[model samples]
Target: MNRTTRHLGHRARPVLGRSGVALCRIGWLALALAVPSARADDWLTGAPLARQLASPVDVAWSGSPLRPSLERLARAQRVAILLDRRVDPDRPIELRLLDAPLADVFEELAAREGLGVTLCDGVVYVGPPETARKLRTLSALKTEEARGLPAAVSRKALARAAMRWEDFATP
Candidate 1:
């Protein structure tokens, strides 16, 4: 046997020859189970974009004279927002929404406004008309909900409320 195998053989004598073999088998089994779990978690947390895109219903966008809150959502969810302006020159825009609620609201509003909303993987598109309506409705709702919610709930709820537009936006 080579040096490494010889060393292992020597070590195995005391362990494998005796009841210690049981310990070795248990160690290997434990390691095997641990390896797959680690791999699964890695995949789960690795890509924000993939996670976002998996559920198109989970995101939305709103456009207005005021810039869409793509940046805000991106910061919240820690994902990159890819913007493309070539599709609509009159209202060229691109942004990423990280917050699910905000995305939902944007989607809803976009639908109501008749904007062409499409979710391809993780990318969100807000057509002109729907984009405008999203801004208007959010602006109005934000003001109304501001006073009624508790501090923490208010923040999360407002974000979700803002995203309620996602439900309205075109699929």
Candidate 2:
């Protein structure tokens, strides 16, 4: 049996199944409507999106539908994850971790579903890998363009601007 769910550094595709989760119109208000028994995880790292990617999260799930699991994770982390129409919200994802960084989880999701996650402004932008790659390329181009400014600016300012856009570029 070939499993699609990726865990930690390993990667795999889901064996056989299809599902979709709609994140649209599902904000915190909607999350409150989820199953009463669902509990939220704590946000251990008090860092920005870039650093928060390495935040530790304890997850234990088995054959859980992609949508609800993700919704729970998002709520726990106090982050909003918006799903693109191209994603299958109902897809099955399995995860077991005593303490794994958020990036590892995101990578697992990508390995299983060919999805790309961009963290910014307390929101996660998820979509096809190709789309994500293109966004990153565009962001890098923007950074390069800034380097070509007619007037030479301080290294600090240029670095800050590049860092700002780099977050959006990476998954």
Candidate 3:
């Protein structure tokens, strides 16, 4: 049986062989991917984007360039946005979204620019449509993961405006 040593962080770990090393790498990749997406969603528990979108907003763009429009939206929504360099930032974009949900505005932008938008790490991304779709998928997965939240603690002091024992004291 072949064996190898891998120096990870402060300690060295052992591997059985080349295949073991590869398997270890794959396991690490999967775990690394999961941790970030899962933790990145802590901020999402409040549904920040939904809350932002739920509130009506007015937008009027008179053939303005894409960058500025995105910047404006980012400022208004207080969300960081990573723009794609490939997209013509100066390309003229026109839209009139009156008191519309934030998501609709993004969808309209995506349609006009032939681009896509995604939410990751509390940031919005505007770029290739495929990338946007992937981001949406990741977001959906994170939401699904959140659905099966850990069981509630056995005992806790709870208070609420509409407090009922049935609400908090359910097993």
Candidate 4:
């Protein structure tokens, strides 16, 4: 019995052979491995910056200057952080913690320095208490104002206007 076929002057052999079965098994295995499996901490996946801030960290500083310590933390956590000019960056700080959430550490520092900490548009802002209080409210208002625009324009405007220190400052 002849089982081969010809197309465009080329012979095509049957593919369901030993090698084909092995290929199929390999494909199934690959697919099974590629699917995302459920995790216990799946709830932590929301809001990337929030997730990063929620990460447990160990920090030990003895009279370290504020600006450099914040820069180091930002680098280590791969997150954006801003220190408002109104806040004294050169202020000496003492922080010692083991396996603490990064947000808690920021709160502690803010309290100790008589400043404020707020997360706006993915960047952590450390500044005057009044500015921090108003940042989120202003961001919400701007967002609501952009809601009527077309999706692309809205996205562009939002990205361009990512919460800046100038937005909170009144001249």
Measured against the true structure, the TM-scores of the candidates, in listed sequence, are 0.27, 0.51, 0.52, 0.63
Q: How close is candidate 1 to the true structure, as a TM-score?
A: 0.27
* Per-residue C-alpha lDDT of model 2 across residues 58-119, encoded as one tens digit per residue: 88878888778877887666555546546777777777876777767776677667787653
Model 1, range 1-171, lDDT digits (tens) per residue?
532122111112111121222222222222222222221112122255445433343433334321234434444454333223322323423334454443454445444544544332122434454443232233334434543557776554333110111212342
Residue 67 error for model 2, in Å? 1.7
Model 4 per-residue lDDT tens digits across residues 21-100: 23222222222122223111221223665666767899897888887787677666765556776777778899898998
TM-score of 4: 0.63
Q: Predict model 3's lDDT versus the native.
A: 0.49
Q: Give the TM-score of candidate 3.
A: 0.52
Whole-model Cα lDDT per candidate? Answer: 0.34, 0.48, 0.49, 0.54
Among these predictions, the greatest lDDT belongs to: 4
Candidate 3 clashes between residue pairs 3 or more apart in a chain or in different chains: none
lDDT of 1 at 2: 39
Q: How accurate is candidate 4 locally (lDDT)?
A: 0.54
**Candidate 3 wrong stretches, greater than 4 Å:** 1-46, 136-171
Ranking by TM-score: 4, 3, 2, 1
Report the lDDT tens digits of candidate 3 across residue range 102-163: 65677677777788765543445577878555543444343334334443421111111111
The 10-residue segment with the lowest total lDDT in model 2: 16-25
